[model samples]
Target: MKKTFGLLNEEEQELLNQLVEGMTKEQLLWTSGYLAGKSEKDKKTIKKERPDMPNIQVLYGTHSGNSEVISEKLLQSAKNNGLDMKISLMEKFEYRNTPLLQNLIIIVSTHGEGEPPSNAMGFLDFLRDKDTPEMPGLHFAVLGLGDSTYANFSQAGVDFHKALKKLKAQPIMPVRKCDAEFMPEAQKWMDQIINHFSGTSVVLRPEKADIPAGGPVLNGVANAGFTVPSFKRVYDRNNPFYARILKKKLLNGDGSDKEVYHFELSIRDSGFTYQPGDTLSIVGDNPPSLVEAILDKFSFGRDEEVVLDKQMFTLYHALRNYLEITVINPVILDRYNRFAGSKELTDLINDPVQLADYLYGSDVLDLLTDFPAKLNAQELVSVLRKLPPRKYSIASSFDAHPGEAHITVAAVRFEKKERIREGAISTFVVDRVKEGDRIPVFVQNKKKFKMPEDKSIPIIMIGPGTGIAPFRAFIQQRKHDGIKKGTWLFFGDQHEKTDFLYGDEWNKLKAEGYLQKLDLAFSRDQDEKIYVQHRLLQKSEKVWKWLQKGASIYVCGDKKKMATDVHLALLDIVRNEGKMDINTAKQYLNSLASDNRYQKDVY
Candidate 1:
């Protein structure tokens, strides 16, 4: 058949045969449609019939899937406007084809610190390298997504834009950087690009605020909020399911320095189903004390009407439920300074180090106290960002406990500037919420941190402190599947007696021979502090063997310290045990990451 067709090679023919051998009729139909779409896209790329309507493509890099979502929206908008557009992952784009592209739209999110998302690293490296040729013909636009709290806000997108400019690519529009409340801005950016490609002028409407039934609005326009449809209903950040708490228990002992709680929520009949690696996003209100303090400090009327998402809400309710108040970021600081006109605050905003120092452990009340702005309720509310949902690693598997979701939360309490402060959501869950109370909730699927589908593959999990949340779900999932012979876990905390979360469960699993290897590191149990990284180093030989046998490694925990330490330890292990040099070992680890054998879900 290969010779008769004069097309596919022997290996390709064999692969195609194997692929189609077990495919159902529906699968075959879907595959045919996908191929046809690809063929049409290829034809458009090669045959440019119109000079004005250049072939356009979208490339995205995402950590939380937001970039991909925006890219999809752009693709749909282009299609609606009778334009041909192909969308791809940044990692999948070949650098060699850079000069061939006509128009490129990049939607990317910055990952930890200032780094590009994992998928964008390769493409970013290619762009930064000296060997890469210039692409004078490429016209592009970039949209960046990030939290303004980070020092390097929208840094990945900034880097891409800068690199493309250095390579002499013409830009269709200046890069747009959006904060967590990115929907309205993202929609506008998409509309601009669609209009540009369709040769249509943008229509500007008059600014007029009106309440909408869907949600609130700000600045005389809807927030462009939308809902995702589920089995029976739609839900999203704008419209979330109110899940009743089934149970809540403090996991820490009396003498423990930390306060950790395990919560189980009933999602029964809510049309929410999640896998082990998914996250549960909780919409929590600001602490009443903090809200009252802010109102008192500003002497603002609680009953004053304020606009949010185009809907009018009482200032009290807006501060309590709809806006962020407990934390401060550069974006908020900049906005507030506009009202306060504080020169000192302006200086701090311009200095990254000073800004970081000021932002740490600070809240809205702190901002008000320091600046002493004479702003009204509406002005104050306008300065604050929307209340983003707090997402936690799901701690229980749906297979193990149907119609329920579980999460582990560690209360964040600290003393700063001679004032006691706490995390908004953590404190809300621990202090304000009671069992049977319905909390607004949604599920965020983490595609990058999923377990390998091949259950027989050996797996090593390294999670310490609250990072152990998803690992618990992984174990529960393995137990439910009744295939847990090749599992290894390294967990640590401050002390084994008080802070060893789920100690009894681990012991039971160990005794039952389901948990093949269990390593514990209690940082304060000994003279010197030891973490999961130390444990990983101690088991270097076995770890190397597991890696050789194709084991997947999962790390979940604090990104600033634990995740960094564990990553370095893994590199050292590969260098020492694999008998390779530093660069080669680094490459080996990169290969593992590329294959999805190494995954991290750190905050």
Candidate 2:
């Protein structure tokens, strides 16, 4: 390590050592690249054409924008390393002509339930087709981003890797599957890929930047947080702004089965500016009761010290704030079974159906109680993953609610196995957090869900339940811009009387003629339990007319059920009313998606 830093002064060397000590392998790699970028900036050297180097085509597919972010990083790193790499979205890539591409690099994310992202669907289909051309001369590498909590984690990456192999394309390296905490792993993967093509290794240099106050300065590189158009002070996961809670109001009335709240957070001095469709990533604490229960089960002292993320903290504090204790995933079970030596747990993990059933509503406490394990504080903490921040759609327009971000959240409480289970972040916001409290937050920008710039372009927003969040922002934005017509919203809930979110606001907007059309579907009130999809079918004529008028459709909600239902309903409308066959209707929808006329932000 000292040999690598022979050029630095004593004080600078000490600082570098401290920084390196706290960083993960992937973070260090990124830090190295960041410093290299700085050095390149200073030298201002003209980049020579790398005609001799292999032509690399980098294609990325993303739903939450993570893959695109990483692809951009990879592209910049490739530039710094003097590599010939061209980046493209998977949707725009010519997958049918894959045999023509000599070198390929894919970074794609899996969407809901093992499905490829919308942008990658067509390309993946091409790969799976029997008549697809063989890419015998192609050399490729794949990196997949996904949440490990899902059963088919990183399935998209797995599919790409297998499909390319089946097409006779040689893999330069094995596919890398990254979990939610994906940046570090993705960076490491990029570095490896860059090194493979470059004639030399990437050189590390001292980073040059001012450390923001209260920021976690690991490896001398600050987290590249959200950026406004000004490009001032980036705030990210490691350096989230502490937004003060401005207001908290219950959206659900009495007699309603749901408990939803509208929260406003003041970002006055945070220098955070976001548009309507961006998300607010909230870093929340685990429920204290669940943390205590786990501590009691281990019979370990709450004061016992445990090291997490290269930092030391009391066992109780770690469980409460740092480690994940709310969800039971295969990763946690696999790690825990090492110390527990429970045959039943191992068997459950091996059987996908049984494992899914057990993990559905179970938490760490449930796992500990069901399979008792005698473990020390370090051992207990080691099995758990870092608590990932939860993202909620920003419910307030930046123009309408200046200096504030808002979210609509529903408390997740359910009865499972005779005990009440609660979501970590959802319950944290609903049950514990209050007005005036400051919580760590960052803006998660969704560029794909951007509102159309054309003022006359109509928007058909289909958002139900808490999914109504971003649409509120959209409506407020339209109001602020003084453009009101051509706005239609289809909102549904359990009942119109009690569960209709923002009912007053919607009515006021309609009365003001700001909302051109409004459709409501209160499922529970009807005998057949009609949802937004059913309403879409019922209004198929008008919906088809709006589509023909070049209306952009936005769907935000549950990925598993609501999104799928609405999609089928839309296909039905296109096929029946447009007088097209099922395949042509499907093509119409696909074309809509390709043209950016259809967008979704589902979870």
Candidate 3:
């Protein structure tokens, strides 16, 4: 029996034939007694030795793919520690069954502005409702991921934690709220969770016992491509399509200070389809010049091969294609500090204020120039973060643009203390790549940012500068559908002569009565600066009337001032004209959000 156990208990054999084949801890204990004639005390002793075997069920509530990734990692960690676990996406798990969950862990990420992710919406709604179950016996921990910059930072996580506590579920650990750059903190939190569950005897059987071996595995690939069901998606950062650039033209005038490009890509044959308000995600390369400069400073050979994500590429290629070399985050600084040849740079990294100053004020190239260090190809790749895709508002309608997709982008180039800094992706598109070049791109659907389906509904648009991108698509869509409802556009720029984007198109549309009203407020055109918000306020009576008629309002522009100002103006319009107090006006706005009457694509 010992020889049999040894033969069958090899890691893979145990995982495949025992752990996943309905072998529970209690069943194993009973079987041990039958097979080896173990006394009851001996079986109890065996259970005591494996006391770390806690049953963990991870319920991930997320709309984006982040929670799925986190859940997969958590499941793997639990398996490595010999804990029986069940992981389910929030949509698959029933919130009403919370009372039945004995030992559980929840990893949820917030979506939109402090709302539950799309997949977790139903679960979150049920939990928030009065009918939620009382889970007095449940021992649970929650980890929330969000961006701290947003007003509702990890709000979903906080809400879930509070709700669980109210329902009498024991909190095994304090809720961990991770920010946009969450990997380091998340890894540490995961380590703590694994340590807390050390030495448990509970065992979990696989959800499906009779599934075939060759089925599509999910999550990350484990044990030679034997992945779980969660990792079946074919498109990701590792494998991206090389999309062809169909058209590229300058949006700004020749004399204009701002350089904005209007790019069009051909997705006709790529099986990519997008609505008017969706976003196009481009997987771009780091500027080759900057990549070369960093390598030259360290005297690193460009041709040396480095392995990343199990795939090998040359040092220069990896830096350009796979690694992030533009942003100077704290993690990158910490990694570089140890290898810095300069004492001053090392000291600066140790100082929190100095580190913050450096990260904010400098780019990746700035670090290499300030403190040169020696690094091999693979070591450098290990230190750098994975390059993330850049998202742009799709500026074309499928009905209007047909096979082509358009985007309005400002080529980011700025000077700080006489050193020129260029945005990695923007500069790559504008200055580096020529026409007919293939750039890897994908569509990121924005379900919330959409026009009303009703053709008779009116729309009020306030978009300044390149924020006018999506409105162009909106107008074209309305025209294509022959919508007779009123369409009012309030657009602003620096100067009418040099700053107006799509000037000719707007003029033609206005002439054709497609654009019912066009209000322009060029800030630099006069001594007194005016903007889209001022125009919005000026048209308050008409706007209020339109709103009363169930018209939808949309704002697309800079989030810092323009969007906020426009939002305030709308509130004021409703307050003064509609006759409501401040709180009442806020409620009115919330009603619009719920009813899908107020939509924004500001960034």
Candidate 4:
């Protein structure tokens, strides 16, 4: 490595190293911003205007504001290059004139399976309708944003690209899908657009990173961690703050088909604070058994040392703490197959359907067990993305608990092909963690999923299984503040006896008159499967009345299944009770979302 400081003395270098190392990412960014601001001078640049550039429009459909932000940034970048442009929200755009536009660039995000975001609902309907226009020479590009872990990842963008082509629109660029970690990828797509339009290639500037704690004091530049929003010194994925587990109790009773627990972590003086809808991100290690199995399969010694982030660790520690051992994504498999050079593995990955099927039911261990490939420690490490933290909704309110953060986790233990398979973080936290044990934790804020500011306003909550987490925080906050708001919770699980999580606390809330309504749906307790959406349907008349009274509704659970089902049930309710047709009812619900009266935190 090049020396950070070429001429600095030993003591001076050490002092500078300590100073940089001690600062957090947030602090570093703040300092850099300060320095840049001080160095800036207001100056005007003369531009050579060319009036012949084609006019462009950037349209966006966003659920949690990500797509909107990206689209706006792109619009600004376009203006910088003098590519006459305008920006429009998907909901507000006139569908009839879309085909008449000169150059169209649509950026949309998908949530809950392959569905377009609420803001884009109208746009989606217009595009897919048979009455929509067919423009033979309309040039366009599409960018889709979604988390890769979700089903139909970037499906909305892919669908848009195909639909535009079907409508005879010419593609200026291929549809690009950005993963959950999307900003960088989104910038790349923008770069492609700029290059095509202006015939000039440019790159987005990378965000400067924060210096990690440890350093060899070689020079001035310190070893740094990955990019993140720089701010306070609370422990995070890059620098996990170890928190002591204060309490651990299984919420399920005997003979239950599932295992769920409510756990509390002590963050009293760690300078960590969380609000409702925030997630308690746990950085869990791989189970020893799984780590050992991988070692056995590769015939690699567990004690072998490897370097990561300029730090050394044993192979076992690296595999457990750093590498993603469970969950096999296509990227990892593709890289692994390249290393293995197995024709069978290569062929399987080449088939999209087969690859998806294999990835869905398999893990990293599955690759080793099935292919039996031999790889050295460094080679194995190169193929692995870091084990990202598992984010569980914060089940307690800071207002209610003061210094503690709680989480509701369900253990994953299932049998597959004569061997037991487990969810990486789920099993690690639920089954293995002890009361006094310390675990790494950080807080992830869910800005869109927040309580209404009006305390007296009513909230209808539908959360089944562990999705009841944030609602727990809501009820706790209400009870603590003594807000007289009318609150309704529709909770469901397999059996009422076992999975009625936080039942005692809820009962107390009811007794104290803080809970206005409590609806329960136990799917297995009755002969027919009943869920929270069923409860919503049963109370359809009242639900419509609540909507009339300007009540906000919140849904949290499985995005593809529960959230979708609940949304359909809601649409049905609106259609029947509001005396509206299916289309109107759907629009009504979409309007609620647009108004921020309908919020969801499903994953």
Candidate 5:
């Protein structure tokens, strides 16, 4: 009788593996089936020792917390299916482990200007680097979120998809990129990803698993800090303390054609203390006339009770206090058109150009009048974005103007088809609100837009129109601190006499030697438009010398054209005066941006 492999004890089993070296499967089969006479039952036992499900990992990169919400949903789906799943922020995960990942899913969001969100920087660097692993066994899917207004929309997602393909990882599902309003598309993409892994044993039912074991309960106290006896003051958008308006003066001179306002808000006992470069964000109500027009079109009683996000309030209150009714976006049009049931609206919603035309030409109130849609309170709130604060440059320094905040605002008033269109917050601050009227306000911290920490360094400011707001604060701060550095300001507008905002202030600063240089280019004062860029070129020698002496450049204005032109002008100076190639000049400018020497606050 011959010793059989299956019948051997544990010690014999270890010895058999050593005897089987260089033996092929055919040789083993022939030895077992004929020479060894092994039973068929032993062969079936070896086949059972394999993993039940494949290993998978999910990663997310997020900004403003939205991507994390989607990741939670994905994780919950994985949990229900009984799959071995893991989640991590892409930045912290080791890229060297990429070769071991069999199934992977990435959820990411793009920031402004098509840059990857701050959290994704490290992960992106590793993926783009040449040292990354060749992961042929891996399969991946990506979901990207971004805003469409940016020129390079979803560039990070596009790069990730391409990089994964280059590494030979099969796509588990097609990459899905969504805009700011991303719910429906995200849901659809998630469904497709779930379907791809359908054979996995684990299944997640979100509705059943989402709720905790205990019944709904109040978990925390409302207004925790307000419980203190000394915390008597209540500051909120709905109920704001009346701060006396100390000044409401026009900044432009008699001959000046632009209308700019310098406003002072008394913050005495308001508990608001802001630095020189901070922004004061105001929560403003929509113009009353616009609200009334919307109500009339919808035929809803103003007193009708409506609930929004579990809060009960009158329809009028919800519209005026909680919802955005002035700024229009595509998602708003998409949902409203469905509710409107009008042929014109239906066609407009389907046509992208028409939708854009509608958004450009009309506010939300205008849509209500043109195509009335009946909406219950909840339905209305569902379609609207929460009212966000309008940020204004804090034009007064705490050291200079104690107990008060100042802002320079260009009141936006226009006529569309002979109908007046008022800017919601600008008009509220400038025209409607009275002295002693309370305005809900908060500070928006600006880290990037700030004056040089070392006051002795020279500074150049280019601000036109109402873009002069932050520069005013900068000047006020420099004056208070008695900074001896050279301060050059390049101010421009429509005309010299009437449109020259803060003319007296700039004149005084110049006379006091606080302003080393005050260059003005009133476009309409001359026959040809003499803008800021032309003035920059006019003083290129001095500007180039200042740059050599380590002066930090700052620009605050319209981003669409003026900012671009000003940037180009700086590049021209680098190329012509600094004698650098175009590429080198660009690199120099980028270096300035990264080092915080170049700063911009443009809308």
Candidate 6:
């Protein structure tokens, strides 16, 4: 920690310490950003003459495109308000040196465990460098976007805020944070910006001050000062449409050891359309049995009233429909351990390696069953995070089935502590959801993962198991579009007869000459187990030739092993077939990635 006395006056230091006491690093970052804006507004409000027209430089760091959406909205709002401003994505921002701007606004989202989004890595490195430029004249505001479930929520924003503060950048306002339901909060912050520039004092909205946790009551009478955002065309994540399931059939034959399913949902008249590279997001709820078990552990009744955000719900309803209970991260665990006062958990939390191991396998149920805590209904609800939605690659093309959407799912069932433990969504679909049942869903665009515009260009797809979902859509769309481009697919699974997903479709496509190559690597079919990576090595010369002829590559599947192995295989192919060294081959693949000719959609 910095020396409080040297940095600020006694009064200011006391306020800072009080605001940050018990806050996580991510929360502190949000506080810093919020303070920057408030401080700048206070400092400039007393000035007799206002500065010249604001030329704002807005920067966005995003994962899954949320931050970019927020940035664009702000940019459009600035234009509408007659403000001169420009926005740049963090990856595209010139990162060779630190940028010095007079007025800036940063909208960044953190992903994983407090790491910057993929696009912001290089830009963050530049800011962290010792030789970064000072910003004495710069006035800035920060707004962090992130999920509260993860341990390092909004961590990237915190890093940037701290770095800029060290360089002497003055804050225009304090760092503000918003959860997934960010539009209302974002709109309020935008209004504050407009008022600040107009030399108007910020108004303390009533709802911001008075609304309780959970959410406002269903009637929405208590949320007086907040304006709920609306959409024009169709449903989205905020308002998903219930699409009925037309079919749910297992792709793997009997006795296959794997249980992969192919589902077709009827989107007829819902206005929900999807592209080949898009994803279908489904919001899942906690299992009632699990929720009841936790309630039993706490000795809490189902009828107990619990509040969240400003809305009220019964303890049972909230646990089943809203809160996440499957995973326990560091932040949530710390709070639980504190409540339980368990020295063992406290010791484990202090050690980084052991804490990670515990978090990996331990869910809320595990935590409670092992070291029970005696938190009230309200306190228990407060410690847990809202359940986030699950995303799956859409396996059907709208061109072929305009009124339907398809997805492939692999059921995750395992034995834990002599009891069956199933994945939240995977098992929910397999066991509970019926053929005629309706599921809430929304489509997410994957523009970069789409097909090439030039129909004649050859394409190579490496999708093993459920990763083949999107590739099925691509090939279907190609057949529908009558594109005669050479398509090569490398698919692998356990056994040839049982695990070959979309087997009939590939055969039909090949017969029609739409597919030029179909390579299969069924590991258990022969003595030695083989995978797609090994198959790629066997076809090294052919793979290199396709790349030489301007073939684009797509990889979709497991990131841990398959993605890494396929990437290595590409490097090896480039080295041996192209007669280049390992480093040169690596650079060549990187160039393809930079140009968006190579794309990935792995989970």
Local error of candidate 3 at 19, Å? 60
Candidate 1, residue 19: how far the Cα is off, in Å: 38
Q: Candidate 1 lDDT, tens digit per residue, 58-98?
A: 89998777888788877777777788798989888865566
Rank by TM-score, highest first.
1, 2, 6, 4, 3, 5
Please give the TM-score that candidate 1 achieves against the real structure.
0.86
- Residue pairs clashing in model 2 are 225-235, 225-236
TM-score versus the correct structure, for each prediction: 0.86, 0.84, 0.69, 0.72, 0.67, 0.78
What global local distance difference test value does model 2 have? 0.84
lDDT of each: 0.83, 0.84, 0.73, 0.78, 0.72, 0.76
Model 5 worst lDDT window (10 residues): 209-218
Off by over 4 Å in 3: 1-238, 334-358, 368-377
Over the stretch 340-447, how does candidate 3's per-residue lDDT look in tens digits?
657797787678677666676466778767776776667777777766667788888889988778988888877775767778778777876655666666676665
C-alpha RMSD for every candidate = 9.1, 16.1, 16.1, 17.7, 13.6, 15.1
**Per-residue lDDT of candidate 2, residues 184-204 (tens digit):** 677678878888989554733
Poorest stretch of ten by lDDT in candidate 6: 214-223
Highest-TM-score candidate = 1
**Model 1: pairs clashing at backbone N, Cα or C within 3 Å:** 216-309, 216-310, 216-311, 217-308, 217-309, 217-310, 217-311, 218-310
Where model 1 places Cα greater than 4 Å from the true spot, the runs are: 1-54, 199-231
Order the candidates by lDDT, highest first: 2, 1, 4, 6, 3, 5
Judged by TM-score relative to the true structure, which candidate is superior, 1 or 4? 1
Candidate 1, residue 226: how far the Cα is off, in Å = 22
What is the per-residue lDDT of model 6 for residues 95-149, given as tens digits with 9 covering 90 to 100? Answer: 5323435677888887545767657766777777786666677788888887654
Model 6: residues >4 Å from true position, as ranges?
1-54, 76-83, 91-100, 108-136, 139-233
| Candidate 6 Cα deviation (angstroms), residue 57 | 2.0
Stretches of candidate 5 exceeding 4 Å from the true structure: 1-244, 253-258, 268-271, 341-355, 369-377
